[model samples]
Target chain A: MTIPNEISGSINNIRPMSQSANRLMNIVADPEYDCQDIIDVVAMDAVLTAKLLRMVNSVAFGLRVPIDTVARAVPYLGERMIVGVSLGLCASHLYNKPLTGYESEEGALWTHCLRAAIAAREIARYANDKTILDVTYTGGVMHDIGKSVISIYLEGSPRKIVQGADSGKFTDYIEGERQILGTDHCEVGAAVAAHWRLPASLTAVVRHHHEPGNSPQEHRALAYAVHLGEFVAMMGGTGTGADTLMYRIDENYKDYISISAKELELVVFNTGQEYEKIVSAMFDGQETAF
Target chain B: MKTILLGVGDLGVTNKPGEELQAQSLGAGVAVIVADSRTGCIGMDHIALPDSTVSLRRAEEKPGYFADTGIAALLEAMKVFGSNISEGGMIVKLVGGANVMDPNSTFNIGRRNVQAVKEVLWKYGLGPVAEDVGGRVNRTVTVESITGKIRISAPGREAWEL
Candidate 1:
């Protein structure tokens, strides 16, 4: 389907990811990047450096002594958390908005994103190989970026959308979106990722987190990891709204990740604990930031 | 009126008139709200998993994390508020248990949770008098202690009494 003019304009309205964040994302995407590369990039951006320090010192990371330097914070938070925090800071406007179109309250999407990020990282722990945990985390954080663009269009018609998606012969909510709005979040999220020049792997995750089977073969495993991660997020009760759990879990995830039922429980448990702390660290003192 | 909020794996009970208990954003988890018709006391539990065997240690720390322990803890909490299930004055309402679009996947924890909650209630010869459970929607459940009324709301749906 062709992009609707209005939707295109909405997509254009999304703020670009900050330069430091984009640079960090690029370095993290490459398999050969070292901790010093991340530290060098983060240190160049004073605001992000301060935020990174604040985040690591927060109770979320649970470091006993307060480490005041970027070099130390870099390895402790690792690739996943640094990228996660950078992306979060970059997209605050998109993440913090009240998705009233989805009938979700303020900060709902942000909470969902944070939980999904944690869940994705946790799910990647069981991967057959050394998965790029940071990539999976970034995928989780940016998976729903399209929702912010499409939410305004969905306002006041949630029942119609739900009934059209659920009662009709539609496969899932995304189909309902395509039929009703001429575009869906996945398409729009892909557009947003492309607009922001996100790494291709992260872009694939944005587009295929709901339907990992359809993603390109190379990026499919990361997509599946994110897919199950978002499921774990919703299962633990941290969905955006209205359309929570409305997406289908591509069962093919079993092919890519090997999490037992007991392991799944631990994923939910660990995600919940980490989610709470991240939420606290991000919002504890800065009520007005959101 | 004081309002109490229940997060995942938490339960609460109140006898004070005008007190309200609420649980929000219950995706696959289930919330069981019990009220006494005569005394107007209310109890609620927001349970995450179907069985406590998932992690006995975590469940031990947070009994309300599972249907079995959560319901048991909820009932025990109600007794302190002068409400008893055997007296027949109690009313139960169930909410949440929304599944991801897949019904066949073992990850359909929502279905399992609803079934587990029902089975636990069955053991007490009890069941929800009214329910708004199962779907692809997150729910926020609220109960008014004084009125003995339960209200269920979702993203798009209007608030309705259970």
Candidate 2:
């Protein structure tokens, strides 16, 4: 009998971020990095430097004076903000990938990730550890890596997946994926992260985000943040998908971050507004047909 | 046919024959309160979250955002399309308020939206003849004005008349 490999094959096909882009990612992720370090890394890519400068000058960033150089943008927007823009640019295709089985329209996943990333940043601010900001943002954006990888395998059985997600019985989406394919998207996503040689902690965030209760203690916080971020996106209605309500919200997440209900609603509202702004700036208000 | 897209907290009415009215991707905390003239007119509102824990007095400030105010606003808009509320010829249909959130969460806003809508409709002496409420799916509702037919569909599922 011959064995068919799906998860590993999807991982192999994924193009990792460019070397300079990866370096920029690390530089921005670390709080120790300074303006010069950010300028140094971003200056290496002419395209990225120009794009970054143009972005900071755009009305979306609320900058009155135009940013003519990477150094100015680095200081103006900060390294963390720069890294976020860089991730969206370098891995734009990853978020833009068409997952017919998972999402209802094109760019639906990207909208979700953008909002989730912003939401993750908001939730991480409330965490006890301030160092997880970059990781939490990265984890939030890449949390659904597995959905794209496993999308093709489930294309034929989307009805079953939707039915399972819409069952309204607190059904676990991962379990539904397992029933359709021998492997689930989370396991596939983690393997892809490993193949990309991403940080183990990041891999943990993608792997355990759906089931934060089972995640390792060290990685649980990021997982919890990402998990909550997903809820914020779905509830806010940006990334409309078949699995919109299929996922579960961890009740203990409030215990982890200590967010009040009023505050949560406010955050969701602010995030939705921000999502529209980001989408307008990036996609030019181009939404895929629903 | 003219079509109107209802965003959250938005309401509209159209009597133009063959015109279509739609609301897409309503979450658990959201509701789509619809009233059809049963001829060539339709009205709908995509009401956003309405917290039952909050009193009606406090929530009434922005009635369009919550179910109580949103449903009232939608019904009021129907008069422009020749809907007679007192005559009870209006056929009401509720298409959203799905419990798409995790059951374990502290709040079940979707169920609350449905509850508030039902209660408000009862007070108005208006009840839905058709309701496709409560599930995990993000419903897309379409109302055809000419025939007064509504169809709701989710991704990867067949669209059916409601």
What is the per-residue lDDT of model 1 for residues A1-290, given as tens digits with 9 covering 90 to 100? Answer: 66699999988887788998899888877766687888888888888889888877877677899988888887667767777878777788898888888888888887888899899989998877555566778788889989988999988766777777767667677887787789888889999999999889989989888889989988888898889998899878788787877777777677888877667767887888778777777775777333
lDDT by candidate, in order shown? 0.83, 0.70
Candidate 2 residue-wise lDDT, B1-162, digit = tens: 677887666777887876788887776645454554454567777766654234365345545566767777777777766676776667778877766454444335567677777788889887888789876667888787767778788776788888
Q: Write the per-residue lDDT of candidate 2 for residues A181-273, one digit (tens) a residue.
A: 877777888877777677767788888888887788877888888888877777666553667767767777765776765566556555655
| Candidate 2 runs further than 4 Å off | A1-4, A28-40, A52-81, A125-131, A164-170, A285-290, B36-39, B51-64, B72-76, B79-88, B100-104, B119-127
Collision pairs in model 2: none
Stretches of candidate 1 exceeding 4 Å from the true structure: A59-64, A74-78, A288-290, B86-88, B101-104
lDDT of 1 at B136: 80
Please state the CAPRI-style docking class of candidate 2: acceptable
Per-candidate TM-score against the hidden true structure: 0.92, 0.83
Task: Give fnat, all candidates.
Answer: 0.66, 0.46
Clashing pairs in 1: none
RMSD of each: 2.3, 4.3
